[model samples]
Target chain A: MAKTITQEFTKGLWDEIPPFRLVLGLCPVLAVTKSVENGLGMGVAVVFVLVCSNMLVSLLRNIIPSKVRIACFIVIIATFVIVVELLMQAYAYPLFLKLGIFIPLIVVNCVVLGRAEAFAYKNGPVRSIVDGFGIGIGFTISLTALGALREVFGSGTFFGMSVFGPSFQPFTFMVEAPGAFVCLGLMLSLMNLAGNK
Target chain B: MVDNNMVDTNKFIVSHAPFWHDGSKISTRNYNIALAALPAILLGIIFYGMPAVGVISLSISSAIIWEFVFRRVTKRSNTIGDGSAAIIGMLFGMLLPATAPWWLVILGTFVAVVIGKQIYGGIGANPFNPVVVAIAILMISWKDLFDFNEALMNYDFDFAMVYPLAALKHFGVSAVDSFNAGDLLMGKQSGGIGSTFGLGLIAGGIYLIIRGIIRWEIALSFLAGVFITALIFNMTDSARYAGPVIHLFAGYTLIGAFFLATEDSSSPVNFIPMLIYGVGAGFLTVLIRNIGVYVDGVIFAILIMNLTSPLLDKIKPKAIGKAA
Candidate 1:
């Protein structure tokens, strides 16, 4: 049981990463990931929610009826989402502002809901929590990777620090939507090649 | 597996068996999409008045005309009846402001159909969303054309509604006092031609969903991502940022999320990946809107997501029973 829990938590990091591997919670990964800091903040928020939601869902898996499970699950998921929203407002106001609608939009992120259905419902509490942590960590790392790449190339900044020499001019397009998609595509392909290896 | 080339060769010979039947009739799916854009057309005219009509007409006309010219120049068969060019024009028009220069609108149509759509072998073959690609080209090449401040500076008594960007530009980047949230929602604000009129845009969106031209997942997730982000920003500092409602209605959020970004050819076909595409567009739209120096997020968002549609298609989960 202990080994299973460890495996579940670690899976989300690479084998079932929410962004690069599983391709879940992409809304924020692509949206606010213009800067490394924004990506880190979003990843942390998602991980927090994933861990809490997974634990709660695992605890109540038996009591929740299969017939109306999705609706009940949404309520449970939404409660955690609201808590995340409030916590962001209370503590990380600037990051909260930066993430914007994305925090509440987490309710619809599919990764959270996908995990609830796939892992938490059938797993024990300890396993579920670890699973969530792994997935969240995986998601955070991927987002930060993409964000750092885009930010450095698009804006000549690394996590908001200027790294380029004076002659280096940022590619404005990299900071925009086109840059985001191109970066994501390249990242996914790289991951796919690595995974295949 | 059946050979695709052999299948095509057989189709030309008119394979009689129903299992092997294939036809060359041009698909009307694109035309049906144009028909769906009618509600957005009506809403634009009603809210922004006659200038809106002129912009749409010019765009559509330029698009169709450009399509004919491109076919002639390329020595390719004419595809005017396909309605793909017309759809591109209408969508491009829907994204521009009512006050945009007529020639620029024509240029936008030309770039959309000629370069963005037709250059890649027309319509479905195009890799980027046509409207967004055109808008981006126009924006990067003709900076003054997209300056909403100049266009909306007059502030006529009846049209005093301050567009989000105009307000932002007028008040400078740091000041938030000039923004009027009401103007943004009610469509009295100055922005893109068809993106305003919040209620009217929603009505158009609902029509598309009801007609089965679009799924609610992409539309809803896009809105959810954008709205949630905007709400958080507003809560953190309402002074510098407008609320979610304003962000949604201020510009092409409704039209783009519902009609433009949802273009079948430029989007993914699978359900889960399709939702990802929509949410990605929505999140990008909001991110660009708040942080970037610009007022509009729709065009950039759509173009960016369009680039990923192929990747999204590749990732679509195989049906439960299908072999991976």
Candidate 2:
């Protein structure tokens, strides 16, 4: 019943894409997906946190007692989240500023904790790393896709550059909070449809 | 006695209560609603010229087309014949300025049908009125489009070109003096294409009410709520708030009471709940108009009340059962 190495990596891409398939970690998905810059930035940060946390959790799986596994997982995830927060602040100050509390919020992201409790805690370090990377990439793709869709239509721009001519009236509704919910719902349904096929 | 040739129609017809259908159809209701709206649309066309016709026709066609295409794609049974899509389109068009861009109309219909109606399982299954949802989104996106003064500036009528609500909102109560009860009643006010003709809307509402298409309780109570609330606001400060009659005649108030607020699925079925929902919406409408940021509050108020409809529907008649 064990998945091959490649299977482990690829499952996260489509089969368990975070926001679309697993529907995990929606706070960053909805809040940070206002633009491609914010989305991709947040995605990279999560990728780092998920990968490092998974690696650490897998390494300590044997030593960590089963009674406090969740607490231990949180401790490990929070460490990596801080590491991500610092790295982003040093190298990507503007993005860190834009992402604000959400960067630290990654510590409690159910996706990270879920992977630790469900996968890393049971799997070898190598497989856990691969799983985390795969899932992280899937999360990134979804965030970026949602961000692109929202930005292009909502602002008549892509990555802050104009997509349409000057006369193009932006559908500003797509940028609002309600618009985020609508966009997320639509993307979820589309992923469902494609998966069914 | 069992003849092999006998069809046994009554035997198969044994089913749930209310077996008599009253010869009514979904198509009949939808078409009747559209027909009732015709007078207002005609007056809008008369006032706004061919642009009005174009917006309306395009909205209706595109909405139906969207519904049809969505059904085909989803492989559901074709429901475009039900005329719900047409009614949604018609209502959406009725809420727009005659000068609305072609793309806006198409996008609005797409929202109304695909996102609003079909995505919510279509027609009566939608939690909110599809047209109201569409208009609310459009209003949020392109606030300038619904600005009657800017949108209808070119048209030269003998009366003022100011939108009463906008005038009141922006320039205080004095700026709206030109829009008296007579002019507003005569459909001389500047507003959405089909929403300004007060006479036509009342007649249409009355016709629908008499025909039992829309519940009279909701419509009458909604108007009474508007009148009472606006009267109270006016009495508190006559110089600040407009009178009750003007509030009733202007913006989406009349159309909303008759059409939008009385939408079947989103409204309550029980009598007391219907009155409460109606009054709550009317009160919110005035409250928002007098104090909120939006120039017109009818759609938002109705939408807010629509959120409470399911809970309100709990206030229903107790069934005769062995256990409470």
Candidate 3:
């Protein structure tokens, strides 16, 4: 039983990584991942929401009826999203402005609700929290890597520091909408290649 | 028994479709295209001087290198000997300013060969012309680099310094009068290295058409489309829109009509679809020039048409001896 719980916790890291492997929650993945700062902020927010929602959903599992489970799960998830939104607004006002509607839209992020329905609803509170953390961390890693790549190539900077010399002409396509799709596609291909090996 | 064994061995020799050889080879086609482009390329060198030569050489070498490296990395067969990479590099170089930076040439060729061609599984498989794709991306990403006015600012010319397309785009039709149709045809205008030589490009295009290297239908229809569309716009508002002759001789129109639009594997194989694709591209080019933000619409227009090529190729005439 202990081994199964541990397996659930670790699966989200590789077996079911949100953005890379599972391809879940792509809206924020593409939107806020233009820079490392925004990606990190969004990733942290998602982790907070996922952990809280998963724990609360697990705690109320027996009381919530199965037929209305999705509805109840959404309410629980929305509550946590709002908490993260308000906290970020109060603490990180600039990031809140940058992230804009995306933070509020986290209520609809499939990853959070998916975890609640698929894992938290039937699992114990501790296992649910671990699962949420693993998935959230994996998502954060992917976002940061994508953001770093875009920033370095698109603007010749890394985490706001100039990495290349002044002579470097940034390939601005790396930051545009098409660039986002191409970058994500190339990353996905690399992941697939690695998996095959 | 010896006769029977020989017949069985001959029967065992398997072959695919197209068993009949027409004596056409990819290398032959590529070399012919290079030969056809010589006049315009020579004119570019004469007008732009050594920098033009440098850009062209670097573009060709870098394109070939990129394809070679990509094939090596992907463990695919080496394709550098076919000369398609050289042709792509040359075409891409022709589209750039004579004063293009070395890095831009290298990067543009990389985009043309690797992202534009190899990523789509290499030559003959790409849905769009590789050169067009690279040029479009460069134009979008670094508009300033492609802006002939700034890129060629250091050079002195007997004619007006402003590129004809830019002048028409920014200052209206009146600004284009500085360049007459004769001068534009004679390659006296300010533009890309090879695109300015209208007469040379037309001659090259005609040579290719004669050699059966490209379809004349596409080239003729594209020009016709441009002429008719520009004529309408000129009639509507002569003060706002330049005439058809100016439109044809101004930008990448000639090069695009002959070399870029008729790129095999991205163009239609049927008669009606070919006409439609060419006319559509020419129409969009004029439309984008007159109203859209870009100064010249050749690249975008060709790309748009290329996107519709697959769908248009479906409009086939009924096959002979087949039910309608």
Candidate 4:
């Protein structure tokens, strides 16, 4: 039984990663992942929201009615998202500004609400927390990787520091909106190829 | 054994559709295209000097190399023998200025071969013209590189150094009067390396049409569309818009009508769709030249038309045996 629970936790990390596997919560993935810093900030905020919302939803699962479950899930998720938004505004204002509407937009992010309905509502508190951590961390890794790739290629910088020689002409396209889609698509294809092998 | 052999000979052979041999291969078509483009290319080389040769050669070799390497990596059959890469290289090089840098040529060919063609499954599978895709990306990325006036700044010409399109764009129609109709036709004006050779382009276009390599309908309708649209615009405001003749002779008008707009994979196949597609591209080219940000609208115009090719191809005439 414990092994099965552990499987549920680890599955989100690779077996069912949010962005690459399930393709959930692409709004934040595509929106704020222009730089490593922004991606990290967004990732941590999502983690906080996911873990909290998942736990709370699991705790109240027995008491909550099945018919209005989606509304309940939304309220719970929105509360956490607001909390993350305010905390970021207070503590990390630069990142808060960078993230812009996406922080508030996380209220509707499918990942959080998806976890609440799909896993947390049926699972116990501890398992739900584990699942949230796994999924959140998975999302963080993917976002950070995408950010790093775009940043290094687009600007010849990683984390705002020059990684390439001065002669290196930045690919500039990788950081633009079209570049975002192309980068994500190539990454998805690479992941599929790797997974198949 | 003899009885078995006789029985095997009597069995019908199962083969895929297109059993009839037309003797048309990709290599034959590509080689013909290369031949068709030679006049403009030679004219460009004569006018632009050694740099034109360098850009053209590098672009061709690099495109072929990129395609070869991609096929090797993907474990697909080598398609470099078909000469499509060379044609793409030639077309892309024609669109570039003689002053184009080596790095820009390499980058453009890489984009044309790898990103534009191979990534979409190569050759006939690509929805867009590989050269147009590369040129569009390059234009967007490095606007100054493609700016004929800026790129050709070093050269001291006997005539005005100003590219006619740029002159028309910035200084109204009267500014283009400096470029005589005869000179523009003879390729004395400044523009893209091969595109400026209006007479050569027309001859090459005519040759391709005669050989039946490209449909006469597309080339004619495209030019007609441009002529009619430019004439309308010229009539509306003679002071602002250049005449249809000037529009035809200058910029990428001639080359685009012949080569870029008729790329097989990205263009319509049927009769009505071909006319509509060609006309639409020609009309859009004039519209963009008049109003859009880009100086020459041919690249974007053809790309826009390429997007509509699938939809235009859907406009088929009724089949003869269909239920009434």
i-RMS of candidate 3:
1.5
Best by lDDT: 2
lDDT of 3 by residue, A1-197 (tens): 45477787688878888888989999988888888888999999999999999999999999999999999988888888899999999999999999999998999999998899898998989999999998998888888999999989888988788999898888898888888887887788677756775
Segments of candidate 3 deviating more than 4 angstroms: A1-11, A165-169, B1-23, B321-324
lDDT at A57 for candidate 1? 89
How far off is each candidate at the interface, as Cα RMSD in Å? 8.1, 0.6, 1.5, 1.9
TM match of model 4 to true structure: 0.91
For model 3, what is the error of residue A3's alpha carbon versus the real structure, in angstroms, after optimal superposition? 5.8
Candidates, DockQ: 0.02, 0.80, 0.46, 0.40
Give me the displacement of residue B175 in model 3, in angstroms: 1.7
Clash count, predicted structure 4: 0
Interface RMSD against the true structure, candidate 2: 0.6
- Give the C-alpha miss distance for residue B134 in model 1, angstroms: 0.4
lDDT (Cα) of model 4: 0.86
Docking class of 1: incorrect
Please write out the lDDT profile of model 1 over residues A45-147, one tens digit for every residue.
8888889999998999999988888887788888988998899899989988888988889888889899999989998898899888998888889989988
lDDT, residue A59, candidate 3: 91
Q: Candidates 1 and 2: which is better by TM-score? A: 2
- Between candidates 1 and 3, the one scoring higher on TM-score is 3
lDDT at B81 for candidate 4? 85
Error of 1 at B271 (Å): 1.7
Best model number under DockQ? 2
**In model 1, where do residues sit more than 4 Å from their true spots?**
A1-197, B1-32, B46-50, B154-159, B169-185, B319-324
